[model samples]
Target: MRYIYDEQGVTFNYFLLTFIAIFLIPTTYFSLFSTDKDAKLRKPSCNCEACLRKENYLKNRKLSSTDRISKKLAIFVAVGWICFAYLVYKVTTVKIEIDVWDPYEVLGISEGTPLPQIKKHFKELSRKWHPDKAPEDKKAEYESKFIDFTKAYKVLTDEDIRKNYEEWGHPDGKQAYSLGIALPTWLIEAKNSPFVLGVYALAFGIGLPFFVGRWWYSSNAYTKDGIRTHTMDLYFKELRNNSTIKQLLDLLSASVEYKELVEQRPSDTTLLPQIISSVKEELDKRFSEKYQPSKRYIAPYCQKASALFHAHLLRINFSDEDLLKDKYFIAERSIHLINGILDIAIAHRWLQTSLRCMELSQLLVQAMWFQDNSLVQLPYINQDIIKTMKLKKKNIRNIIQLREMNDEERKNVFKALSPTEYESLMRIASIYPLLKIDQAYFKVAGDAIITPGSIVTLIIKLRI
Candidate 1:
């Protein structure tokens, strides 16, 4: 019917709430907004090739589990912190009342008063406040005071009571133990019982299971790489023994993950035609028509993604803001999808297909498409520059071959590039990995002759 609350229990609840808020604030912040510390933004104003590449890198960067936080959780954390602040204010302002029975205070005498002096004082107090001597109207008040005076006197004079008081903080020994709920008193009242039960039912019965079920279902839908199992199955079914780079692009474009990234808008009905027209028109400017999208029926969104990806490989700069943004995110999220395809290829024991997948993954990171001259990876080099130098005539397929050329030949190849541009290009070229094998041999330890079916160790010394 009713519940009692004391400053002790209420203060404990306030402190408990404050403690919970202290931990939840940071936990919620990290869960909702945490990101990679090393992720840097490129200057939006700088449209240089390097800045463009950096922009793509930032957009397409794969998020680790720790780096992915949703904005919805941020709102929850903010509200929680506000409540916590109020709890903290209550804790600081509340006046706690603790019932401490002090013999000296009750008897109105200083501690360590001699027993004779204490007895004399008690006798004076007893005579003055004794109920027999009090007027009828004041008799009850005097009686209560007298009882407390007698108890304090006994605690100071009697050996056993003094010992109990000293040991257990009470003349009669230990007081009854109480388990404070550390919650507001009104929470447990009869009228509030249904509301409290409903909250408990909503949280544990409904909310908890809902969240756990959602997590379990979502986890099962995707592979360990976070690619959907159904998408992986599609990739496996479509992959052939001799799948080409373009085929791999098609597989990547068709992934269901892009559905979430490339969301449709109310204007897409009219906008889709413009996007398709632009994608086709820009792609034609680049000479690589072989990498054009397949004739097979694909979801409109998937087709847009596929076309954008092909344009990306050809280094086609898009004029549409939404298309560019979508392309960047699609490129980023595609990392997991590509890895999923790689896994499927490896499982099927398709070595060529597996290597192609690996190559595509790397190309995705560099924003280069397959069949582009490897020279495009060098700084300040483009299709026009590569054609002007007649690099193909010199058979310089890679930076390594370019590095192998004599000083005169290298100078002639880069003569068109400015001196500063040439220096930057050379600097990037130098960083390319070049493996050199120094020695190779095989032998069995402590054996004069190698025997059939015997394990042999092959030692190779290599430098990069």
Candidate 2:
């Protein structure tokens, strides 16, 4: 038997080789079957799982922990208990017995040793072999020895059993006693019923994760690729079909709501820093629970970002002598602000990872992609000392094409793009490939770190 010990010294029996499985096993059919899952709980303003949960909890102020537990965790607990009960029952029923041929030898006592002396040896041995203090790798060995010590202690303590053992030199007339209490007879006797164990094996075996992965992969594939299966042609098609820079150009165009959206913008760069400082002070006062910045500071963070977005984009000048510098200023400033917040969010356990933020960042990088790599490597200009580089309107338009396509006949299409386009895509992918469209391809591309959820969802691919 290969028994293992938890951090608290709770033993997992040798029969159930499920330490990895229990921790890594995905949630079962319940999560897949639920129609209104976290999709409904997601908040529109923020694109993070932690913020979503926090917002949801703040909205439902009246619901208690018990109500939430019953609605959410009850079914999970019940399903998990199925495997727990089976493993426990299997491991505990080892049918151990004290041979009792020599109680003196078992307890390390002489034939006529008094109870006090006998207990002295038992205490010393018990302390040495205690499972809680045993080495992690040698847990099972110590546990087995501890069980023997306990049974020896039990037999030697019982006067009648000791007397019989001493006189008969064996437990010939004694009835065998169990180390632990017997569970209900029905559960133990159900060993004869192959049907019961089969159900257990099926639910907890490799089969369960195999089924769940298929469900998850299929749904995600369809979401990103429509009816297309494993092949991501449809997904890549939609990906390349985007005209993000064109949309931004249209938004900034004089005709459509450009003047309307930029009525009166505020410039409060200090507001965000002040809010962050205030939240930090408040969080410092609390000692019981750790506070995450993202969860605590999201509202104020977004309030500031909304002001900056309009102030910059809406007021952008197409004819500015230093348009590229202005674009870089906006991008770098935005990146720094968000990156600072992201660092704080990641440090806390409550809010560490996000897929949507990564996706949006990647899209922005794509929109900002420059064909001339050397442009990015140019020496930094001293903004206050040097006049901005004057560039022609034709050169600007050549680098930044955002005009809307009329139709398929007139639309600009690039299949197997030229070396320049390919280089641009490679640059963006190298910097930010966080969307993780295909996990296998993600690994091959050298970007395969995935976040774990409340229930560690195991993704298994099966060929039928």
Query: Which lDDT tens digits does candidate 1 get at residues 267-344?
Result: 556655665566566445555443355666378777778866765665666466676678777787887788888887
Clashing pairs in 1: none
* Residue 74 error, candidate 1, Å: 9.5
How do all models score by TM-score? 0.76, 0.21
User: Can you write out model 2's per-residue Cα lDDT over 1-464, one digit (the tens) per residue?
Assistant: 33222322123343243653453244433444555443344443432332344365444532464367556665665656676676667656645443334556766677778879888889999999999999999999999888767766766788775576667554445444434322333434556568768777888786888888998986875433133232223222222223343222221121111122222223235443443344344334322222233222234333333323322322222223232233334444443333322332344432313332343344343322212222221122111111122221222121112122222311222222444543443343344322322333222222256444333444444332
Candidate 1 ranges beyond 4 A from true positions: 1-6, 9-14, 17-50, 53-89, 104-149, 176-181, 265-292, 437-462
Q: Which ten-residue region of model 2 has the weakest summed lDDT? A: 377-386
Q: Number of the top candidate by lDDT?
A: 1
Q: For each candidate in the order shown, give its overall lDDT on alpha carbons.
A: 0.77, 0.41
| Backbone Cα, N, C clashes tallied per candidate | 0, 1
